[model samples]
Target: MLQLFKKYSVVIRFIAVFLGSYFLLSVLYNAYLIYSENQTEFYPDFFTNIVSRQSAAIMEFLGYSIKLEPHETESAVKVFVEGTFLVRVVEGCNSISVIILFVSFILSFFAKKRATFFYILAGIVFIYTINLIRIALLTIGIYEYPQYSAVMHDIVFPLIIYGTVIILWIFWVRVYSNLEKNESQV
Candidate 1:
């Protein structure tokens, strides 16, 4: 049993660090959600409103007449393009949780302090921008095509986010995190 534990020790440590950081961050995120929910201003989804407004501004920049307004209960924002309601920007669409997950995975990598900090900051900005663009594109796609909305939202756009995270992880493991010398090595 001792020998088996020794053999798989690296794997065990990896799992513990990954899961521990993920859970801790997730708990903090939930606490933030609780606090946000208690607020009267856009209760429960402040970030979602921010994203929605940003997305609407982006669409307007591209010559699309877009209006983003709060929902009746104010739990979300309704995206209107060319005076037609198209999408609802909800809490899940805000990308905060995705950023948290990205940070968790990056934390597990544990590279140089300066490098890690900058990487996380840059990565979060990248993800948030991409999510805003994604929402704008999705709204336009749904408005124009309408039929392929499900495929675009559920499969294609999700792949973009998840795949970007996977790419970031690979880069970290192969390059950034590789600075951490293996204990089994000299």
Candidate 2:
């Protein structure tokens, strides 16, 4: 048992770190959601509110008239494009959960401290930007082709956003592996 544990220590560590960090971050995020719900300043929650506003801003910048109104009875923001109700921006649309998942996976591989920190920061920013674009494009797609709204919202947009994260993970793993190889050689 001792020998087996030693041999698989790396795997054990990775699993522990990944699960631990994911759980901690998720709990903290849930706490924030509860706190934000209690506060009157932010409708829904801070992150979702910001995401909705930013997405709307992106659409407006592209010359699409956009309007955002807080949902009266639910924790969501109603998004209208060109006076047409396109979609509702909800908590899941904010991308924080996605970022948390990305961070957890990256941290499991544990690389150089500074490199890891910067990579995580850059990854978060990239994910956030991509999410805003995804929302904006999705809204436009729905507005123009309401018949395909289900496919666009349920499949295409999710693939685009999650696909970006997967690509980032692949790149990070490749780079980390190369670094490990070089260090082993040295």
Candidate 3:
């Protein structure tokens, strides 16, 4: 048992850090959700509201008329393009969860403190921007090609955002993380 543990120490450490951070962050996020639900200031939480508004603004800037309304009975925003109901911007569309996942993975790899902090910050911003673009593009796609809404929303857009995260992860592991140095030393 001890020999096996020693042999897989690095892998175990990565898993531990990843799971630990993910759980802690998720719990905190859930708590925030609960608190936000009780507040009257920002409907559907601040992050989701901001993301929805930003996405709507981006779509409007791209020559599409956009309308945003808080959901009647749900914690979401209804997004319309040219007065046509297109999609709802929910909490899941905000990208906070995705950022949490990305941060957890980066922390698991463990790099230089300053580098890690900046990388995580950059990653969060990139992900948030990508998510906003994703929402706008998805709305446009659905509007232009109503028949392929499922493929655009369920498959293509998700791939784009997640693919970006995966690319970032590869870049971090290859360039920023100390994994290579540690391996070489061994």
TM-score winner = 2
Give me candidate 3's TM-score against the actual structure. 0.94
Off by over 4 Å in 2: none
Question: Cα lDDT of model 3 overall?
Answer: 0.92
Ranking by lDDT: 2, 3, 1
Q: What are the TM-scores, per candidate, against the unseen true structure?
A: 0.89, 0.97, 0.94
Model 1 TM-score (2 dp): 0.89
Cα lDDT of model 1 by residue, 1-186, tens digit: 999989998777778888898899889888888888767676346787788889999889988999877777757788889999888888899998899888888887777788889989999998899888888888888988999999999999999888887888888788753566653264
Per-residue C-alpha lDDT of model 2 across residues 1-186, encoded as one tens digit per residue: 999999999999999999999999999999988888876666788899999999999988989999988888889999989998778999999999999999999999878899899999999999999999999999988988999999999999999999999999999999999889988999
To one decimal, what is the Cα RMSD in angstroms of model 1 from the true structure? 2.3
lDDT of each candidate versus the true structure: 0.84, 0.93, 0.92
Error of 2 at 107 (Å): 0.6
Clashes of each: 0, 0, 0
Clashing pairs in 1: none
